[model samples]
Target chain A: MPLPPSPPRLSIGAVAGKTVPRLADLPWLIGYAAAFAAAHQAAAGWGGQGFYSLLYPAAGVRLALLWSRGPRLTLAVMATELIVQTIAGIIVPGQAGWLTAANGVARPALTYGIVVWLVRHVAARSQSSLGVAPMPLGLAAVTAPVAATMAALPWTLFSPELTGVSGLRQTVASLTGFVVGDLLGVLLIAPPLLWVVHAWQYRPRALHRPTLRQLAGLAEAAVVLGAAIAASTLLAEIGLGVPAAPALLAVAWIGLRFGRTAGWCAIVIVAAIVLPFTATDLPVAERLALHMSLASIVVVGYLAGSFADAQARAQSDLSRRDRMLFQAERLKTLRAMSVAVIHEISQPLSTLAIEAKHLHEITVAADPDIAQTAALIDRKAAALSTLVRRLRRFGGRSVDEPSALPLSALVETVTALTRAEARAARVVVEVSPIDPDLVVFGQEIELAQAVVNLVRNAVQACDGRVALSAHQNDDRVVVMVANRCPDRREARPGMGVGALVARAIVEAHGGTVERVTHADGTICATLSLPRPGAET
Target chain B: MTLPANQPDRAAVYVVDDDHDLGAAVARLLCRHGHAAEPFLDPVMLLSVYAEAPALCIVTDIMMGDLDGFGFADRVRMIDPAVAIVFMTAWPTTANAVDSVRRYGGLDYLEKPLDETRLLSAVDEGVAWSRRQRSIRARTAALSARERQVFDLLVQGHSNKAVADILGLSPKTVEDHRAAIVAKTGTNGLAQLIALAR
Candidate 1:
């Protein structure tokens, strides 16, 4: 024979809205009731006496069966209870026993049926609230008392011995208990569990460590949290008479601060405080309404907080994208610069290598004095090699790190190094007087690289005359490299390697760089850096 | 030091370039090797020098401000039909090589930064070819007008009958002219006659 087909699975949201329950829903109800019974036993002493002792177990079973499935599972549970009582009576063999068992089974079956009706009604109302149409708080308030009165009907109608007691009093007590229990279940248990499961499904792992700046942002967030809570609390006290406004404020603050986890903790604490007091006098309908209201607030706050967090994360991503683009552009400029440098330097280096080799051979075979001359030539070649290495490092890939560097000394050194190149190309390089003690914070290698690029570009731009000058204005130090290119038209601003790199370096150091073409056709690159100890 | 008497018929090596340093360097190297090398900074100067004496081999830079190496070689070939040309460039490419072959009669192309060893070797090869061409010219110059015409006809692969019809003479007269051409060229067979034509 073929195996029986399994029942269809329904999502939690579907369970909340479905009109009829499936066969599998009955076992789920039993499990829910058993769990509630265990929770009640753990809370109150398990050995407690009297009918009140049974109340916790009975309420647990009722709530578990109520929320686990629809009216169909509830009706099955009621029938199961009746069957159990009838079986006990059959075993006992007495008229009084059978009559008492029948009465007991009948009463509970009636009460269970009422609970099923109440749960379905409330679930319908909650579904409507989730839709585009707004849920009326007035309708919920009225439903709480009505559902409570229905729950109490079986007890009142079956016990005729207590005829003098008003039905209204019993109805009120039953309604209060039902409403309180329902509110407690939703507010204390629902949102946090949903949030945990949602978080697990969506964001399962942390990708990055918090940087120093991000840690500082977290500190700022704490201050903002405190302020938002105070503001929300004041608004809640003025609007709603609930004494727990401050506590609700605290929950909202934590949600906005550390996010969803802390928010749920705050919700639980507030619910535990409010549930007992609100449940005491009111009918079941009013109590349930109160719980639903509180739950709604927590859910809305959590969602809003998550949205704000996502926006902040997106902004951070944009900043990182911009930084990458800037780095890529800088790299492209460096490549072009290296190519130009290679083309310019190759001829000189080749000539020096060949001449040195020839001189070495002649000295080895001829005069002793020529040996000293060859040694000097070798030293010059070594110096050129060192210069080439420096140029390569300047153009090569490296991370940026800040250190104290003597600005004037760096400028002077680059000028001296490029002097020979300038002379060979028949161009003049002049360095103006600068303060000896001026120290700027930057990556020394990068700063030197940028300055070299600018000077080289300026030399290439001018025919022969180029001036490098430095001046201090208040808290800023400005270095200007100007070249006279009278016949040449204005070149595109950021064309060469040095100008592009100079801008990157200066900006990296929290400074500014500007290129100005004068009326006299002299192109000037001005680099302005903050004076030592000056605020950026 | 005794100088050789002016051999007016001796072929001269031509050096044409825009770079003063490179042209002078090549001229000095050529002089050391006992070859007459004239250096010109411009194609116009090279043309002027060629008016005095036809060059044995022309070495020129491909890139110049005016009259690039290819155009100069073409003009030189127009003036003197027998001069051989070689090209030097910083950019060596197959297209340039093909172009040099097509336009300038298949001259050797050298890439710069020019290796001195390769430059000298190419120059020597060009000079040796020029010497062989000079010798051929000397032999050709010794032939009488009628003998030269008969030799040209034989080199064209015209049989005695075809040669007699084209020359408007009898086949016997054509045969007589062919025998004389064989004697003057010092060739024993028709294959040797083709070798002499080359």
Candidate 2:
């Protein structure tokens, strides 16, 4: 029987490790509820919600909270909204808190849901890049106001709390006031709040307690605030009321001085300084209109600063990519040049060595005692060949196109190749048998080259008394080639091309080659590489 | 100073190289030194000359036209693995060349612009290695079951009395088998026989 095919797996692998809300989330939830209830009461205390709200900041607080915490914390939003709305209903006369609490859940869920979806959609559509992109986040900014207004609109029909029991025109006035207030609140407050939170998180590396430059930025923000407050007070004194149009030219100075994050903070400080003038003795509608103007300047200035930052980031990113491309091309040329030079020299060296050996033999046969000149030539040719081999090893074009290779085969082949050279040097080569199934991820020929270099070096160092051993670590394989030469005074070439090239090849494979000369004169070279498919 | 290459003319040294002049030069040097050496400038020329019997040794360059020294060695290996090999190369830094030569039971390598001494010595070694291999094969072929048992004991350094005691045979019978083994192998004594065993 065909062994009943296993239940068709959805191949989702495992539950994507369920996201657990942390202790940090507990504070954000509690703080959001506290801020919400406090801001609502504050708004009502300044003036009952009609055409204007003096301190409507709950929506802005929600957006700023969600910015860092992510949208998965919708449960936190809804939970906080539930407690705040219930308390507001009980406090406000004739509003049924229990019956209307469902709207609180629905509103945040819809508003943030749309905002999160749009941000995700824009990010997915654009190139996932290394630099900060303000355009997508600017688009996310626009979504918040639209979502807040839309979420509020449906509630207008049912909840008298939002629609109001005033006359139809008054009701119309209140609805416009609601949209203007919420949009202004989110735009004016969320960006600066998010900036502060982000700053606090990475402020160590971001500012390191503010340098002289940062102090200058703070001075600029102080100047902008002082100017905005004086001008707003002058407008109120002259009975022109608060115009709420921020001195844009002066703010630009702050923007230029403070950079984007501190620039947003400066804008917030200026608006906070001018917040008192908007709550003066004027009609609710006029005051609300003034607030809208104030919010407009803040939102527009924030977006301008964001745009400037994104543009600067994009420009640097472009230059860096170009620089890297040019650098990579140069590296390629260097390698090619080295390999070509070695290969060219090899053919001629072969002819030279052979001819020298031949001449040495002839001289010996004819005049054995006077053959030293030929011997000298032969010795020099051999030395040149050794130098060429080292040069080739150093600058050789690595045959290092990577693939998965069995560890045992790698060891066996390298040891076998070095065996004859070992015998010639009077070195005994011993290789420990390893598990044949173990494999490493690397370039096969380059790895072989690296291992062979080590083996050859070992043979040269200690009369070829070498031992090779391999063992598997958790996600890596370590091969050690060791040679024992008890004499300390016999100096060998310290910085050979063979060692350099071996290091290069191993490092390229995300592996390491370490050489240590022991107290007892045992020279050891160890090569370690990540196992196949370990994602190293 | 002399090698056991008595019949040097009978030992054919095949030289393969893409460089025609180099091949001719090496062949000339070997011929002057009393070996029957044949030179082919192209690997294909060697392949084409398959009608002749396989040589006792092949002296080939590592880098050649179309088919390289290694490819030529492999072809020759397929035909007669007993033939010894000696690689002559310009690119001696090629890491795998010498090892592969040793892997195929070749004698050794000669760096290019071939030295008469090294080339001649390599050829001498190749010829001797090839002869020993052939002699071993012939001796094994000629051995009867009982003679093979006697040869195996003698190779282990057993005296004739010891061999007879181990095999439950007469001492004279063991001595007879041992003599036949030595005669078949063309070895002088126990020392040569021991070398042949390796």
Candidate number with greatest TM-score: 2
Docking class of 1: incorrect
**TM-score for each model:** 0.44, 0.58
**How does chain B of model 2 score on TM-score?**
0.72
Relative to the true structure, candidate 1 reaches a TM of 0.44
Error of 2 at B190 (Å): 17
Off by over 4 Å in 1: A1-331, A345-365, A368-536, B1-17, B44-49, B70-75, B91-108, B134-169, B179-192
**Predicted model with the maximum lDDT:** 2
Deviation (Å) of A69 in candidate 2: 1.4
Worst 10 residues of 1 chain A by lDDT: A46-55
In model 1, what are the clashing residue pairs, if there are any?
Answer: A144-A285, A148-A175, A175-A283, A175-A284, A176-A284, A179-A284
In the order shown, the candidates' DockQ scores are 0.02, 0.14
The true-versus-predicted C-alpha distance at residue A16 of model 1, in Å, is 27
Score each candidate by Cα lDDT. Answer: 0.59, 0.69
Each candidate: RMSD to true structure?
Answer: 24.6, 14.3
Compared with the true structure, what per-residue lDDT tens digits does model 1 show for residues B56-95?
7888988788798888888888887667788986434455
TM-score of 2: 0.58
